[model samples]
Target: MTDKKMNFEVSKYDSEIAYLSFPAHPGKGKKGIVMKQKELSSLIEGYKGPEVYLDFDENGELIGMEILL
Candidate 1:
């Protein structure tokens, strides 16, 4: 298992919902995920800050984070 981090942009967001995406994809359209504030905060360990990317492991565990302002 390996940890991975990818760059993403804040495509759309509101008080409760956020959409993240990469500008380019290999025929997969846009690579992105839609998450609620509750779920995102949990992955970020309750730290409310400007986050530009996400970190997860092969087992799909949220293990690390990066704050790209």
Candidate 2:
């Protein structure tokens, strides 16, 4: 991954969801974290909890995560 800054943003509606974005590789759409920019290639359940999901890019690099709140 490029050495770009990452950003975080939460939903305005009662903070139901949050987004972590990689500005270096911006994508299109909004389904979750990765979906907020890049297209989701695959999603893996986070070991920490069921509400956490790890998002990956087409190359299999971790782009961001989504946590249900």
Candidate 3:
């Protein structure tokens, strides 16, 4: 098996919400996921930023998160 790097872009929908977008490519298509303000806060125990980092598996699939906010 080989590790494939995943790509995602972060954007804030509001002061209380944000989302991640994985652009479409060849065999894959566009996809997105949202994180609520409450969820974000709990994740980082006070996460507040305009950007965040995401983690994925060898298959290039989102596993949860590692927010940088």
Each prediction's TM-score against the native?
Answer: 0.27, 0.55, 0.26
Tens digits of lDDT, candidate 3, 1-69: 334444444434534334343332222332543222223444686656744545454456544443444
For all predictions, the C-alpha RMSD in Å is 8.2, 6.1, 7.6
Top candidate, metric TM-score: 2
| Model 1 lDDT tens row, 1-69 | 324334443324444333343222222242332222233455566677655344444445443333444
Give the higher-TM-score candidate: 1 or 3: 1
**Model 2: runs farther than 4 Å from truth?**
1-3, 27-50
Q: Which candidate is the best by lDDT?
A: 2
lDDT of 2 by residue, 1-69 (tens): 666788787877758788675654365465443433322233443434426556676566677766676
Using TM-score as the yardstick, the better of models 2 and 3 is 2
Q: CA lDDT of 61 in candidate 3?
A: 58
